[model samples]
Target: MSVFDTACGQVRGSGPDRGVVAVLGIPYAEPPFGADRFRAPRPRSPWAGIRDCADFGPVPPQSAQLPGAPSWSPGDEDVLSLNVWTPAAADGAAPGGPLPVLVWIHGGAYTFGSGAQPDFDGAALARAGLVVVTLNYRLGFEGFGHVPADGADPCPPNRGLLDQIAALTWVRRNIAAFGGAPGNVTVAGQSSGAASVACLMAMDSARGLFRRAIAHSAVGPCYSPELAGHLMEKVAAEAAVPATSAGLAAASPQTLVKASDAVVDAYRQNPHSGRHHWDPVLYGPVADGVHLRADPLAVLAGGAASGIDLLVCHTTQEYWLLDAVGSSAKVTTEEHLNRFAADFGLPDSLTQGYRGLMPEAPVGDVHLALYGDLMFGEYSSRLADAHARAGGRTFLSRFARQRGGSEPVAYAWHCADVPFAFGNLGEESIRFLIGGAPTAADHHLSARMTAAWVGFAATGEPGWEPLGASGGPVRTWDAADTTRAPAPGHWSDSGTVRTLWRSFGYRPLRP
Candidate 1:
């Protein structure tokens, strides 16, 4: 049933059980198609009648090769839509009372992903006494490509970021009617989603839309204007068209998709030739003057977002899942070891250091640990340290519980903590990760973690002290026990590892 009608003439929603929810998929801006295809987002037209809020609206155009599932096109161009979940009836939630609102942005490396993934069901989070919202924005070339204009003030790149800002603005204006506290909002996301949260923190347009943020795997890399232009040119050449909005927009969607796929295929075959050696899909945020002032790490190091509370973390065995997928050939010899070291940009000394640490471990296991630390651990630790240095309230954690059925050595891989965080331990994806069925211990940890997350959204504190506070504490969640203290040896020594990483030019990438 409809809960409330938004100013844009879209009906906000409620869940099936009659519990309070307002799934508003209002268009914050006009469709990015036709003449507006690659231009900056413009304000939506004011509407005259209530719009239906029955099903998820069209996802932004993206590649079908997104991780974790098969992708297919769901044809429609109204891609700018948002879904909201709340706890009170539309008309009569105390007028000024505040309830925390959590806004989730999905991750797909800036090219693919949607708010409609089964794993990101906001129902559980909403049921736990908070309002949850998720939304879709443009992707691929449509969201990021730049076109020259003859205006006095040129539009900076990063139209995807602009879409996110627009969505947040919509929340600021309309969420309160669905029992959400416009003043107590929290922005949370994973992977590129986390990167988007970091960008939002740095963007002036996003200020005051949310009071706190939870950035899981927060990335710190952005594309330079030259680099983005080069990639766009390559895509245009592959499509046999001029590198302009008019030229590319005239091509059919299938033709554009094929051209993009061909470019990625070529890169995959000879990675060193392209700008994105490792991933063709890595089109991150750009440092356009208006949307992003500088790289997020630099901004964080300079105490940006100092006033906001943050919960930032990483999985312990972050790279094992990728290894399991990419290299079925187990690392068995020193030759294999050396190859992996070069691939992941591990320093010779650091590789030696890990070799010493795991003298008896398999070469593959060592490689997994090394890459995991490089990709997630060091960055997460640095983020915590940066937040602490900036005078922001930051709570850091490491998920160490190994999935049940997999090899005991697998540890907590990427996205492993999501099920526990959302209290969906029994879902198919969660069960696949945890093996068979979730035990009582799983339920307990889920409740505790979700409570901590909800608590963070509610207040600046997340049931733990900041990493570098006077108490010098951080949380560690495991199956055996969950506790907080001066971040155990693992988190504290990340700076040393990070230093070693820098020597090899293995910079931490953020968006």
Candidate 2:
């Protein structure tokens, strides 16, 4: 049946093509606008009749016009909604009982992304025996910007995170009606979304909402309260607000987006600007000591998220995507490279070691490699290592799939593994991300990736060994050897690359 019952009303989805039905634009929380703007999410009011949920809800306010995804228009207020894609069940009940659920939070550096993106379609995942959910929450300044306290009005920090928790709560109470088991849920994301997963694991309010997590290329060094306040000051200055809760609320979302854009442009134009000049991302989860107890790695290593299975993965060259997209700054000479090292507080020895490793590479190439590892690769690896060391069951892997010759975006890089895992390589909008049309090997690789995700969500057996006391094997996804799973990825991270970053930790970045 295409119609299903929910807590507030009934919803009729649009499909059963190959056994999958998607109920889109279901409100998990009330609209976070008007009287509710900048506050924690509240329950949506009960409706009178069935809501026609045939399309995605209005997206959070963002400037990014992603491929095959709608950008936020000025007057869209009902932004806190979610979508579900379930296998067609027998009379509103799955034939083989409820399936494990996977809730996805899309990533665009915490500013712009939607669950309705073409790459995140859940039909393949539903066919793989999963009840898939994707959601939209507040973004940019509306979600992550810091606002001052205003007594009873309750302008809370990290409203985006609260929206996510509200969505999960809705799933817990209503997923069973859509052929999903409430207790068997996996929360997964990439980049900023992955970092949100790490944050959720440490939150007391999010406890018991899900049993597993998959973080791919989790970004790090969350904003400290002071840093968040500082960034908001810049945003307010540009928006002509007074940097107070009341003042911030007075400005419109579209205006704040333009202000935030101005701040990023200023950073881009100045080469001598601080750490943010390299990659001027202005919004992320704030470790305010109330919502987030501490950094996620610290919380996970301290055994906060007990009995949770964790799986982590990262692409070999994560920064290449940013460089190719012109989002990253250029460092062309040795002097510029040395200055880059000092700007992020990296030691000269690290650059020396990298030069020694890649003797023939130019300064620009070396900068990209080092920056990529510093921002994503090393952080993700360390998270997995820390979680495993704390006696948590963890699995780690690397995506080394790359295409040679002259495709600029051909590297096995950031965001490349998502389509493969979601089994949506054939989507027209996904061609640029995958470097033009797909190959037979790419399709085969996508199946293998989806199978791995399915296996992990089902039984916690991801076809490889769990991390042992010291280290564990990593499953490699490569196009070169789709014929057979290559040699088990050994605990090779503890060697040269990791040694250089051994003393490093996630500190609040400065501008």
Name the top lDDT candidate.
2
Task: Write the residue-wise lDDT of candidate 1 on 146-178 in tens digits.
Answer: 554434235447888888888888888888777
Task: Put down candidate 2 lDDT per residue, 446-469, tens digits, no spaces.
Answer: 998899899999888677777765
For residue 194, model 2's alpha carbon misses the true position, in angstroms, by 0.6
Can you tell me which runs of candidate 2 are displaced by over 4 Å? 150-152, 405-409, 480-494
lDDT of 1 at 304: 72
Per-model TM values vs. the true structure? 0.88, 0.96
Assess the local accuracy of residue 38 in candidate 1 as a C-alpha lDDT between 0 and 100.
67
Global fold similarity of model 2 (TM-score): 0.96
Which parts of model 1 are misplaced by more than 4 Å?
Answer: 10-18, 22-24, 65-75, 89-91, 94-96, 146-155, 271-277, 327-346, 409-411, 469-471, 484-511
